[model samples]
Target: MNKKRGQQSVVFSIPPILKATAAIAGPMEGEGLLAGYYDQVMEDDLAGYDNWEKCESYMMEQAVTTAVKKSGHFMMDIDFLLAGDLLNQLIATNFAMRSLGRPYLGLYGACSTMAESLMIGAMLLDGGFGNKVVATVSSHHNTAERQYRYPTELGVQRPLVAQWTVTAAGAVVMENGTDGPKVTAATIGKIIDAGIKDPNTMGPAMAPAAVDTIWQHIQDIGREPAYYDMIYTGDLGKVGKELVIRLFREKGIDISRNYEDCGCMIYREDQDIHSGASGCASSAAVLCAYLYPQLAAGKLKKILFVGTGSLHSQTSYQQKESIPCIAHAIAVEV
Candidate 1:
């Protein structure tokens, strides 16, 4: 039986294994340091599509297909498709699912959808409801910019604190097997509001939520910071990553030794990505393309992946509502 931990976590007795993974990134990411890690790199954000949204859908389609193929399974072998994106109504995910012809579930966690899908998929597999599932997410710089901020056509000036939304997609195939890393625990975070309303400064807005979830996960699992070889957070960027370290110091726990943000890892300093990267793919691409390989190679033994999101819509922002943030944590072990 699964044991409930503390207030918001669970320890699984039958953890699900990650069978295969794939990641596809756009031109900007392709030029980054981890370019060699991705399976496919698009020369342009349009990806030969008429518009950016459709291009995002195409990226997701390719990611899922590649992941399934790498798993040595056909499309029919997948039991469920769990996915989402940054677009309103998840247009990218919906369109991709329509063509995949698989039983699917749509999710919206702003940028945290990747980890959310993985956790839900793990539950289904561990509970014997399914033997195989695919979790995927995508985001496009052009599509997200016009919807959340200014139109890309205008070439609006981005603030120094602003983060670039990544044009990428990533997918992971999970199954009941002993060939890979297993998800051993999960911590579901609660919504946290820190009275921040500036959409341009999302790192500050979402940092508190990430810290909250990280603290809870450690306490609930009764593990110290040294328990994991490393701890990775979704997209907190440089500023937000520092804030997490400071916040943890205030709580008498230090995580600086084994902590890194995918946002900081995705882009290079000369890439002009402002602070760093953000989006659903900020974490997904990094995990699938880089971290998974390290774990599979026995370079890393244990890790905690925390997906963070700022839950705010254009309407909510226009209404002067502060951003509400959330984070979910998954424990992965080789």
Candidate 2:
């Protein structure tokens, strides 16, 4: 794993851990920076036109473009696609893939889509379904608001810990006959509830789902945190991540030493950010952008990236109720 990122490899793992690998996520924020085209697209209230739709479409395109570039592979060369997005309709992901014209298995797991897609695509390739596959997931603050929580015109202040529906996209190209984690075993997650009341406090709402999936992974495989070089949970931010650590430790499992929550690792508070993370693309961008580069450099030998999302509905919010959270973890080896 990339501890003390940009400093040096803080931990060491056995060599030649895995060979099969690729990159596909992107970034949207930076110091005093806004990614430009996004601002233009998002500003458009044109044609009753929605920017979230545009951003989602763009995320897929960006991921496809990124995968092809990073792997030095082409779009047509891909055999299958596993893709998704957190939306009322899976339009963004599907439309993005439609442009690529590759046969695919469409999917949705909210923020966890990238990991879900990766698990399935890897299994497809490793199972000999195809020689190559591509996986991607995308979400947008603008579009998701319109569909799930609010309309663009509202502009209400989001909670301090609220996640920014990541403005970018993520993707990866998977190739067979390479030495990586063999897609050996997996446990599907079920929704979990904590009965949290605040609509703005997604952290508490999503904690149970994170715990549920983490618990299932350990129970099904009968493994401990030490079994993996790193255990990562997608976008749980500081609050949910803390809850997960406490809950897991009580179960005689300790993931804290080598564990990281993508939500917390990617941002700095002094950097004009609070509570550290937001967006479906948070984990995707990290995996494809940062982790892939490190893996190729022989830094990370094995990693388990878990993606988490709140599955609350609009009705639930209006009813002054709690939200359901869902999470999925995908273990990726060098």
Candidate 3:
């Protein structure tokens, strides 16, 4: 059967179920709004590791292992592992995979990695390529700062537009089953460069891309904005979240009522995170920790998860290249 949907989407012939999920957060995140939702909260960012990078790897490892254990399966039972992180060459994920000793594919979707992994994992299962798969993502605030902007020791003054990168990791087990929330459909996004260059303004830089994918998903699936109980965009902080609402409003749609950004959901107003959270873990932590439980408990029936990415590198920024962004959307139902 043809599972292809519109120009950018596909309907899963057999939606893969989300068997189990786990999230691990650093000390800062443990003090955040969704602290209670996480599977494990670390006492510090290093988690007893020698460095922040190793801590990130440890978080990913723990998240993946915990998720698989929660699924009532062992690492040997998993068919494949798809994971990523926001470090140079994905060192964090690579190191984590090394310890996990599972067949793996490393993905890089910037902050959109969690959704990208889920989309591909679902496709693998529905295509009969794999019976069970693990999708995971990780990000560390210190690591991101050192690579992307400045060293944390510099104690650089951040602008209000800037967002805090989350120190966390999240993982989920997807398999052929009817026990949990299922991946129903997905819309792959296109690159959108709105000529934004300032990395500090990532939320605005990625807002247009988020809107584009969301609009495309709605069109491809023939669903209205109200179709889903909630719509979430990954890592688009307060600024980007508002931009999406305004863009949709201009297009004669009202998404403000049911829409939220995972970035904005993580930190509290008093956390002094400036705009909010940003990083792969922003959405990953929220999805795995909070949203999954809500879905499992039937508090939320259907939802649209849009992963937003700012495709800019330190080299690109140094070269004065504009930030190109992308977003991928997944439809999940219980």
Q: How far is candidate 2 from the true structure (C-alpha RMSD, Å)?
A: 7.3
Each model's lDDT: 0.93, 0.66, 0.95
Candidate 3, superposed: residue stretches over 4 Å from native = none
In terms of lDDT, the poorest run of 10 residues in model 1 is 149-158
The global Cα lDDT (0 to 1) of model 2 is: 0.66
Q: After superposition, how far is residue 86 of candidate 2 from its true place, in Å?
A: 1.8
Backbone collisions counted per model:
0, 6, 0
| Candidate order, lDDT descending | 3, 1, 2
RMSD (Å) per prediction = 0.8, 7.3, 0.6
The sequence of per-residue lDDT tens digits that candidate 3 reaches over residues 184-263 is 99999999999999999999999999999999988988999899999999998999999999999999999999999999
Better of 1 and 3 by lDDT: 3
Per-residue lDDT for 137-205 in model 2, tens only?
Answer: 776656776777677788687667666556556777777654543334444567787888675677667
What value does the lDDT take at residue 267 in candidate 2? 57
Give me the displacement of residue 246 in model 3, in angstroms: 0.3
> Compared with the true structure, what per-residue lDDT tens digits does model 1 show for residues 172-287?
99999888999999999999999999999888889999999888998999988789999999998999999999999999988899999999998999998889999999999999
Which residue pairs clash in candidate 3?
none
